[model samples]
Target: MQRPATTPLSDTAQATGITVTNLTKTFNTDSGLVTAVDNVSLHVPEGSFFTIVGPSGCGKTTILRMLAGLETPTSGTINVSTGSDKPVTNSMVFQGDSLFPWMNVWDNAAYGLKMRNAAKATIREQVGHYLNKTGLTKFAKAYPHQLSGGMRQRVSIARAFANDPDVFYMDEPFSALDEQNKTILQEELLRTWEESRKTVVFITHSVDEAVILGDEVMIMTARPGRVKKVIEVPFERPRSVLELRRQPEYGEIVYDIWASLKDEVVGAAL
Candidate 1:
């Protein structure tokens, strides 16, 4: 049984975390009605990183949007109690650059707080803190147009983190970067997650990325997505990406995920 919202959650309940029960979503296109998601459910523990990997058009992003409350589910419940007195706050980082082209990095990073009517001093402090953490302090004055793709994404990450959301929904935020840049950002993200310990639900098609960052990796099927499997990642925290793949179990885990994913990947392509 669940406790009332006002009641404090037990340590076990707090660790039980974000729950998505029987979630479904559908869309109307010119072709016909489409069911993007189908009765999907998940429980992502608080302060743990959860990753979902699937074939293209498999509704991974749709599931993420539903969790973020950006899309209305056809039918389902998403319970995201933070187990804290403060209301749950959620933030999302998109696949492509989402920064305002006209705003400087600092202004863009401060936008969330400004919208919430946070005091100027509070906005200044939080923005400064995240920008420094993301290694963007030097570029704070630059506009989106002036920075490279990877740099622009850093600003978006800073903005999301500075908002200090209780849960983060990331839709392949590092997918656009080159291998070098992606590796760097992935390392930095691990550092941030280690320090902040915020709950994250991340969607990616990259098996390697999913395994490296997720506490648990969920594999979804082709369109009308459903969970194929959920594999617990046992690698200890403060992980080194450079050394991650070298671990003996790393290849085994990645291979298993891919084996489960192969048919769906081919099906999506057809």
Candidate 2:
């Protein structure tokens, strides 16, 4: 199968990461002006998994939407460049299941390719590959309504992976699953990421999940969020989420995140 090349990675993109500078977003609700994100800056290394952890309603998702070009930043810049004119393809996996109810799993996974006018052979090959990776091959004929929450989420992941986006924006993609299902999906995600080395920006409330998946974890403040700090995950790659929990460094890092997170959690409540 021919590798689809929507956006060729230039020398700059391969070396540089995503840069968000002084990014801010505001919304006017019936209650008046509300600032969701304030001066949130991030530098996510290219091909690295970056996770953002913060309290609920802390504008974590807002930041991701902005990066994905779904939301406009009120005052700031997002430079996802390699200092070149080359383009890059990106896709988003939302918090809730974003499957097409009218389409079966196979079609939903292949939808992006179809939109791109990719060859049928390419769509079949790519969709088949990701479905098998996510353990959805057996249920390829199943509709989203016929599947469980975890199964639907798997279809979503498969869809995103099949699209072969250069940059992936994920907002709590695994938050809906049970422990067993979440663990399985996490491992599957890591394996796929290791193979493709695509840049990923994942948003999760679980500090454990953030640490387990991220090469660097960005902690955000309470409401009108800003960057609290970015902590590098010291563990080597090919990480086992189950085993990493037992490691001393993993424990310390998880503790450190909570130590910073607790105050924000409390402050948000007040």
Candidate 3:
């Protein structure tokens, strides 16, 4: 994740990911300086999917928010590799509904492209491709209110991919879904990602999810969050999420991560 300083996307167009050094965030609460993240340094390689798992309030969302430019770090530097000069345009999908209520499926999916003033033809190609990939082609004119929870998330996924950002920040995007829908969406996400291989930083509470989707899983300590460990998931993709879960090794990895995370979770509650 940290070979060199970030060059312009023009220089390294396909390169994506982040190099965070001593990243810290503190909130000036009435109680005092509440440090959320503390001197956390880690690398997320371009084209790799890295997932972070930590106890509640362990700064998982804070890190994602920082990467998405929604929050400012108290200290340290985050170098995000944009595939282009448009770093401001990087895509993010959140745990809740982030879609525009007024926009139909097609429009919502194409919203990013439209905002960037992409050519109509290019918009059509990208939106159509992603919508179809997400099984939303039949619902092109459907509004957010017309969709189910899973369907709405699919639209969010479609929109994120249609935008084709250099890096993607996803914070528990499927966390609200039932197991069945979550499973389906995870598979869909993997299929699309298999094709694009875009850099993604995902945060989840589920150990299984972190292992299933991430090439490397980062375990974070409780508040004043720091990297506890970065464990490699050696399973090769394009993966079958359910089938992969059935693997003996899969159970072992999930159990191992849980073993490490359980301690932090306890500490957080204390």
TM-score each candidate.
0.94, 0.93, 0.92
Candidate 2 lDDT trough over 10 residues, lowest sum: 1-10
Pick the winner on lDDT between candidates 1 and 2: 1
Model 3 has how many clashing residue pairs?
Answer: 0
- Stretches of candidate 2 off by over 4 Å are 1-15, 82-84
Q: What lDDT would candidate 3 get against the real structure? A: 0.89
Count of backbone clashes, every candidate in sequence? 0, 0, 0
Better of 1 and 2 by TM-score: 1
Candidate 1, residues 1-270: lDDT per residue as tens digits? 122333246545444468888888889999998999988988998889999999998899998887777888888777787776666788999989799998999999998898899998899899999999998999989899999999999999999998988899999999889999999999999998788999999999999999999999999999989989999999999999999989989999999999999999999998
Q: How accurate is candidate 1 locally (lDDT)?
A: 0.89
**Cα-based lDDT at residue 134, candidate 3:** 93
Candidate 2: TM-score? 0.93
If ranked by TM-score, best first, what sequence of candidates would result? 1, 2, 3
Model 3 per-residue lDDT tens digits across residues 176-254: 9999999899999999999989889999999988999999999999988999999999999889998898899999999
Give the Cα error of residue 266 in candidate 1, in Å.
Answer: 1.0
